[model samples]
Target: MTDPTPLTSLSSALADVVARAAPSVVSVHSHRARSTGFVWKSGLIITADEALADEGEVRIGLPDGSTVAATVAGRDHTTDIALLRADTSIAPVRLTRTVPALGALSVVVATTRDAPSAALGMVSVSGQGWRSLRGGEIDARIELDVRLRSSQEGGLALEASGEAFGMAVLGPRRVLVIPTATIERVAAQLETRGRIARGYLGLGLQPLRLDDGIGAMVMNVDKAGPAAAAGIRQGDVIVAVNDQKLSGVRALLRTLGPASVGRVVDVAVRRGGEPTSFRVTIGERPEA
Candidate 1:
């Protein structure tokens, strides 16, 4: 008969991790919708912004079966993270800065109606850094091989050691783990300013090949946009931004981060077989 010790030990270890992380997990209720959130700090909770409705009041259900009223301290739609402040206190989960290895054991701890529940999975994808489809800069890309319910969107992604790798959110088609570095960075800014500022160029572009290499082909220009004001027109191939060679749409979007707003930068483009440069000022993206 095969030894059962290994399987028994693995089950016990996972139970211990869930026990340690359960106190930090809470059910967040906003405008009749329910989701999960983890205590980021004393009186502070972090949740998925997309799960939150544009309502006035938010409530947090604690492990002790009591609920506390919470206020929306800040939110960043770009990163899909929201910060909530409450009067109650709970032990915050320990966030690990180290990235988890691919195929490593990971757990998703979520709050159910009565108690905290856990789901088992493994790290399926890991990368250094990347941008989201909406142009948000993610410090590290981590994806899990688990299917999560809508209520588990803002739950914790914990390593086998019980250290939090990040917060789990439902992506376009799969589950995405927002790394700890990104959570900390965005949370700090949101806690301070209540919103993240993003730079906008106001030009629709498509990836196209130029004589030198790959470039972004401008498809449409906003008449009142900074790009239009700087003489950027349709059919122009943008090859470089601030002297950095552009390879695709991702590179251009990555370059236009929050800091690029209002900054004047040189854009190199190929027009009629000759390289031309245009000085354009970045603008703020209009709120949706």
Candidate 2:
């Protein structure tokens, strides 16, 4: 027999990797959503929170054409990770802490409603830790140069060596891989408490450009919230927090991440054009 060409070798290697990882990848079904999920532990599966239906009967379609009922153990929308509790014996994927290098080849082993599926792509962008738009702290920024369907949003992003690295989720304009570090952190907390604790100021803010700098004007204040107790009122234009000048509305919101809970900070505001400062204690955001 003639030796396989380089192209044939590459093709066979990719197929082998997909075959090795496809068993742990399952299709998640809900009343209004169908997404991919992977066995994170013996009885827990992790999937994309954005694709999971808020209220529905959830089931996982296994590799052997079997389906099992699952319940929402926890879900964090900020990081877009959801944990499901199911009675499944599917082997959990052995994931690596390796961050995908930029331009490196990768594979997403996922599942459709019927069977296992695969998407071949490359690591388009890789960078250091960054925060999401919803103020979630992601350990690394890994974007994939591949087209993924809505049903395949929560697939397993893997290395060419068949080593699973992270869970792939849909991003605004690109496919994002939620690295192992983030999944380990958020999923642990969710499994323990069923929710991630985030800081809250209880003040609705709008961005306003002042003569000196940008300010966030308080549009509404929760009557019994921390800001109200600190004397922050509606129409008060907040100029700074902890002496750091305000950048914009989004910036202010980002500061209220999990680490800010119970922390005290100086909030400077222009009330009736009078410079006033209030020491406010950040509180936990109430569950929706």
Candidate 3:
């Protein structure tokens, strides 16, 4: 028979992985939301935005049974990543850009309420980049076969080699990893600017049918916005942007992502049956 010691050693190694990562794994408490977060930097914590309460005092419970008050540094709902600022000295997690392979043995180091927790599973699906329903840009689509609790939403996903790769959050039917690349990208901007800006045209549009293609009727325009500066009126019907068909309001929004900010696009509109073209510089969407 094959030696059973190998199995025992493997079990001990898995537990060691969790133990090594537990100090940085914190139990997050914000209003009524009880979830997990990991220290991203010396004084910053990253957690799942969907699991964080919108407005409340944020706090994190440390491994040594200590708690510290935190404040919302920034939050991006589109990607379900939120950053918090606190006075903590727990060692920050060393994140890797490595994408796990399918069927790779994985462990999720998280916390339940005020205590640390761990779950073992496999990388069920690993694919290329994907866009979220809210138009957020996710670097990779990595799913796990692990069963995680509601309080373990923002745990760290690690490989058997003890490589901390990404943050695990509960997705629709499975746990998804917010890859290290995406987290590093968004967290840097949030840490510096307090928010990630998206492009905006400042026009409230409704679908309008035209003879040749789809158009959007501008129901409202911000008087102080770029559209207004470009001579676009509320009743103007926008036919195309940069020669692309305006199929729907969502289509228009899709064009106004992060890269669109500061970009100038030719907006073709119809005013009183007269076609008009204007070069308008897209502006950053104002914070709500």
Clashes of each: 0, 0, 0
Q: Of the candidates shown, which would achieve the greatest TM-score relative to the real structure?
A: 3
Deviation (Å) of 94 in candidate 2: 1.6
lDDT over C-alpha atoms for residue 52 of model 1: 92
For candidate 2, the lDDT comes to 0.93
lDDT of 1 by residue, 50-152 (tens): 8998886899998999999999999887788899999886987789888899999999999766379889999999988887766677899999999898888
Q: lDDT tens string, model 3, 1-288?
A: 766698898999998999899889998999988999999999999999999998978888989999999999999988899999989889999999999999999999999868889999999998898888888899999999999999999999999999899999988988999999999999998999989889988899999888998899999999888899889998999998888878887878876777889999999999998999989999999998
User: What local distance difference test score does each model get?
Assistant: 0.89, 0.93, 0.92
* 127 Cα displacement, candidate 1 (Å): 1.8
Tell how far residue 49 is off in model 2, in angstroms: 1.3
Model 3 scores worst on lDDT over the 10 consecutive residues at 249-258
Which residue segments of model 1 deviate by more than 4 Å?
A: 1-4, 202-240, 243-254, 268-276, 281-288
Error of 3 at 135 (Å): 1.5
lDDT of 2 at 262: 99
User: Can you give the lDDT of residue 122 in candidate 3?
Assistant: 97
